[model samples]
Target: MKALWVVGDIHGAYDKVRALLLRAGLIDFGGQWTGGDAHLVFLGDYVDRGPNGVGVIRLIRGLEGQARSAGGQVSALLGNHEVMFLAALVFKQGDPHDRLGFREYWLENGGQPRDADQIEPAELGWLAERPAMLRVGDWLLVHADSMVYLKMGGTIDDVNASVRAVLAHANPDDWGCS
Candidate 1:
């Protein structure tokens, strides 16, 4: 059987992630993919908490391409933090309610200001396209382990489509509801 590797809740710990991947021989010291033909899945929460969220995302995105070229696969699931980050970026002016805006909410929840500032349109589009859940063989991968995904769809395709639709919209309320 092919080997499968899983990582979760990176929280912007780029250095640690790099070190771990190096130690595991998944990447070289130069931070390039070395895990040829290996299946690696990131279970989300790629941003906030630590630092270098942008770096982390960039690394993973690069690795995805490299891994594909090497006959390996690198995939990511969408975590709540990703949603919070996107919400903040898309709705920088804050929500309509007097409570708290997306930016404020993200910051309050361990979001780094630099990460928010460094995000580019491509990165935002990439993050928005991530699926809320994924299935590999018998494994049903989800970020939150919540039943809320059922509301998205009965099938994985449906859920991913629904999430894509939600992300494509500009309304903060739509994002909040998702």
Candidate 2:
């Protein structure tokens, strides 16, 4: 059986994340994936809070390719922070009636300036395209412990589809509903 690992709510704690992975023997001193053929799943919140959100993203993105080349798999789920960040980027000007705009909301919620400043288009696209939920064997993985996903759909595939659709439109209401 292939080794399986799951990590969640990184919240920009790059050092802590690195230490944890190192302790788990998943990565080496050089921060390279050493777990050949292992399946790793990140449960999101890769950005915001602490510092080095961009660094964390860079690490994960790199690890994804490295893992794949080693016959391993790296999967990331969409978290609320990602949605908020994307919203902030897409609607930086703020809404008419709302006191706080997307950027303000994101900042208030621990958004790191460097992360937003250095965000690449490809990174944004990757975050926006992540699935809201996933299922592996008998395990069902979701970022939040709320019924909000039900608003998307009954099945995992449906929920992912709905989330993709909402993200495609980049409409606040659609994102809010999802």
Candidate 3:
């Protein structure tokens, strides 16, 4: 069997996340991908609630490319927090989905202002493009442990396609869920 690793709710804390990966033998001190072809799955919430959210993002984004080049896979799923982050970035206010206002919504939901300010265009795109769920062998990999995915679609591809559509829309009102 292949080496499979699952990580959940980073919530910033780059040093801690890095330490976890390091201890897992997935990365080295220099922050290079050392896991060979092992697959690593990050179950979202990569931002908010802690310091160094942007640093955590950079590390994961960097690792995505490195892992791919090394014939490994890095599956970073989208949690509700990421949805809030994207919504906060694109819309300043007046989102029907967020009565508190998009920016305010994010803040109330553990968003870090510094992290929001430091986000790059590429990073935003990367975050938005993340899958909501995935499957590895018998593992039904999803960020949220909820039945909401069942309403999204019948299969993994169907669910992803549905989420991609939701994410692709310019207006926040079009997003049925956040």
TM-score of model 1 relative to the true fold? 0.94
Query: Which lDDT values do the candidates have, in the order given?
Result: 0.88, 0.84, 0.87
For residues 78-141, write the lDDT of model 2, one tens digit per residue. 9899888887777665465233477887889998878989989998988888988888777888
lDDT of 3 by residue, 72-173 (tens): 988899988888888787776665545547788789989999997899999998888898888999999998867777778999999888887888887667
How much is 42 displaced in model 3, in angstroms? 0.3
After the best TM-score superposition of candidate 1, give how far the Cα of residue 21 lies from its true spot, in angstroms.
0.7
TM-score of each: 0.94, 0.92, 0.92
The deviation in Å at residue 6 for candidate 1 is 0.5
- Give a tens-digit lDDT track for model 1, residues 116-152: 8898889988999999888888998888767667788
Looking at model 1, report the run of 10 residues with the lowest lDDT sum: 91-100
